[model samples]
Target chain A: MARFKLTIEYDGRPYVGWQRQDNGPTVQAVLEDAFAEFAHGEEITVFGSGRTDAGVHAKGQVAHVDLARPMTSDALQAALNHFLKVRETGISILKIEEVDAEFNARFSAKGRHYLYRIINRRGPLSFDRGLAWHVIRPLDAEAMNEAGQRLIGTHDFTTFRHVECQAKSPVKTLDYLRIERHGEEIHMLAGARSFLHHQIRSMIGTLELVGCGKWTADDVTAALEARDRAALGLNAPPDGLYFLRVDY
Target chain B: MARFKLTIEYDGRPYVGWQRQDNGPTVQAVLEDAFAEFAHGEEITVFGSGRTDAGVHAKGQVAHVDLARPMTSDALQAALNHFLKVRETGISILKIEEVDAEFNARFSAKGRHYLYRIINRRGPLSFDRGLAWHVIRPLDAEAMNEAGQRLIGTHDFTTFRHVECQAKSPVKTLDYLRIERHGEEIHMLAGARSFLHHQIRSMIGTLELVGCGKWTADDVTAALEARDRAALGLNAPPDGLYFLRVDY
Candidate 1:
């Protein structure tokens, strides 16, 4: 079997997330359907690096597919893009490369990066309404940054994990965490070997409280030490989170 | 009567355009309805700085509303924001200030800024799929910038305007023209006292030709002097164009 690694981009607004669900359309199903057409009478399955919740966008998502047909990667990429374009699929294939038979897009990845955007202003940023979180009050950037800094390093992040997370363990090695402010917009960047379900969002939710002066850096540290899910703050809304990259 | 000036923002995807149309909902109609409701039995009208074509977004659009009530600028701003929030209108009133009785939003504008975003890559940008123009091939930024520099002056832009333009003269002063590249995206900024219909888009189309090496900077100058509408290249699509700001 020829294994093709695909770099994908998708607008998650119209999707029911990246997984196949009976409830509604999904990015995975859309790509699988496209692959089926490319295979012509052959069933096709696609493996994604991770699952993103509905309304969560991805600028650089990686996936892999194996097919019986032997075709050039460039031709396959062009054909898939053309097919997706006609359906107005909101999804596009950025690159296609033939990988070693053993290379798995998801399992071979070393780390992932995510960015959460917050529009902190008295007036709504209509241009990015659903694409970013809108907060009417001004945010304290220094406090938010200090609180986020506490999240760096490896630890058991059970407090920031979702109850339904399928990951085997809550322990994760977080490589980087930082908050940047550009005018009225605040961007939070997080990098790790992998993330537990809703972990980054939960961390952002706790940091938002710090920016609002409701919590301090010490509070975030305390939550991490507790290692109990109940110790974590509310999960921030999913509109602002984006899968930026996956490093192999 | 209190002459209230408003700065507005909108996504522009659902509306037919900024102006009210029998075909679809408009930003103007939405604002008028909200204003009329807030005024109780009093009639209200919102005047926009300029009409944005269908699917054209705005980050800083200026408007004026007339109300037969005594209200502070802060109160009106807060009230309208609250009212618009309830209907979940894609449009938002960013700022409101009491203006002179003689002031009109459209006629008193000193300058306008526009930005056209182009994603120069093989894949789509998930977050801004409908908000940007995508080009599969890499473009020459130096060539595009050279060609754009030729358009930064007063000239009869008849060749770069739509035949349906309402301006009495094709002559207008272009204050600035700049092209910047970020990652795989190309952003073009234009500033002028006023613009003819589709002026920025048409200019962008011509510049794109230069970027592709299909034409040269001197060719753009020749097209300008041609005066005939047919002398110019195609009009760029509206997806990437944004009404960035207005100087009052």
Candidate 2:
């Protein structure tokens, strides 16, 4: 079996999530169905680096597939894209590369990057409704940045993880957290080796309070120290979250 | 009667056009219906600076409205937007202000600014599907810009005007036509006092030929001097066109 790594980009608005399920359409099911045509009717199962909730977009999501027949990277990409186009699934196979069998899409990942987009404008969104979070009031990116720094480095993220997260530990090392403002758009970039479910959303929800002048850096620190889910300030919606990259 | 000016933005995916037509729903009809809710059943007509075709978006479209009942600008804006939201028309009133009775939205405009977006890359659009024109082949914006300069200044733009254009004269002065490249996106900014039907799109379509090295600057001049609609190369789709703003 030849292992191939595929980088993908997709709009998550019409999807259940990255995983396969019986209830509704998913990115995984669509990819698998597309891959079947190129695999001579052999069902293909693709393993994703991680799961993204419904309505969470991905610019550089990574996955891996094992093909029984050897094929060039270009042929694989073209064929996969052709099948995807037929479905109009809003998924694109950005690139494909051959990789060693030892490289696991999920377990071998080194780090992950996520971006949260917020449009802090008085105008309600028209073109960017599902692509960005609209915050009616103006945000203080400087204040958000200060509060973001308090959450960096390793810590027990119990206050941030979802109550139903299956991760064995609540501890996580957030390598970096940067808040940047470009005109009316505010972006939050987060990097970590791994994250418990809903960790990024929880952190952003709390940071938004700081941005709106409802919380301070000390308040974020207190929330972290609380080490309890009840201490979480908020959990941001999935509409504005994008899985930027999965580093290996 | 009180005169009010409104700054509007909308995603034009679901409407026929900006005018009132019996064939399908339009932006004007939606606004007029919303206005009736606030006017105590008195129907009102809105005069837009210009009309945008179906699927043509707007970031800052301007219009003027006359109300029989006097009200503050803020109250009018809020009520109009409140009524608009109930319908989920994918349109929003960004701002509103009181204006003089003599200020006609169509005639008082000194110039119009338009933006044509092109994603000149191989990647298929996921986030910007309807917002940008996707060209798979790489485009040379520099060449397109050079050819675009020929369309600037005063000229008989008969070749660029649509067949159904109702303008009395074909001679029009184009203030500027600029082509700019940012990463994989190419933006064409066109400015003029007014435009003939499909004029901007016609120019952009021909310039695309220039960008792909199929036409030269001299060819663009010849096409303009030809003064024949048959000499036109193409008329770009309305999907990539945006009615950016009107300068009073």
Q: What lDDT score belongs to each candidate, Candidate 1 first?
A: 0.87, 0.90
Tens-digit lDDT string for candidate 2 (A63-101): 999998999998888888888883379998888999999
lDDT of 1: 0.87
Error of 1 at A147 (Å): 2.3
Q: Which residues of candidate 2, in runs, are more than 4 Å off?
A: A86-88
* Tens digit of per-residue lDDT, candidate 2, span B194-246: 99999999999999988888888899999999999999988888878999999
Candidate 2: the clashing residue pairs are none
The per-prediction CA RMSD against the true structure, in angstroms, equals 2.2, 2.4
DockQ of 1: 0.49
What TM-score does prediction 2 earn?
Answer: 0.92
Off by over 4 Å in 1: A85-88, A124-129, B21-24, B78-89, B124-126
Worst 10 residues of 2 chain B by lDDT: B121-130
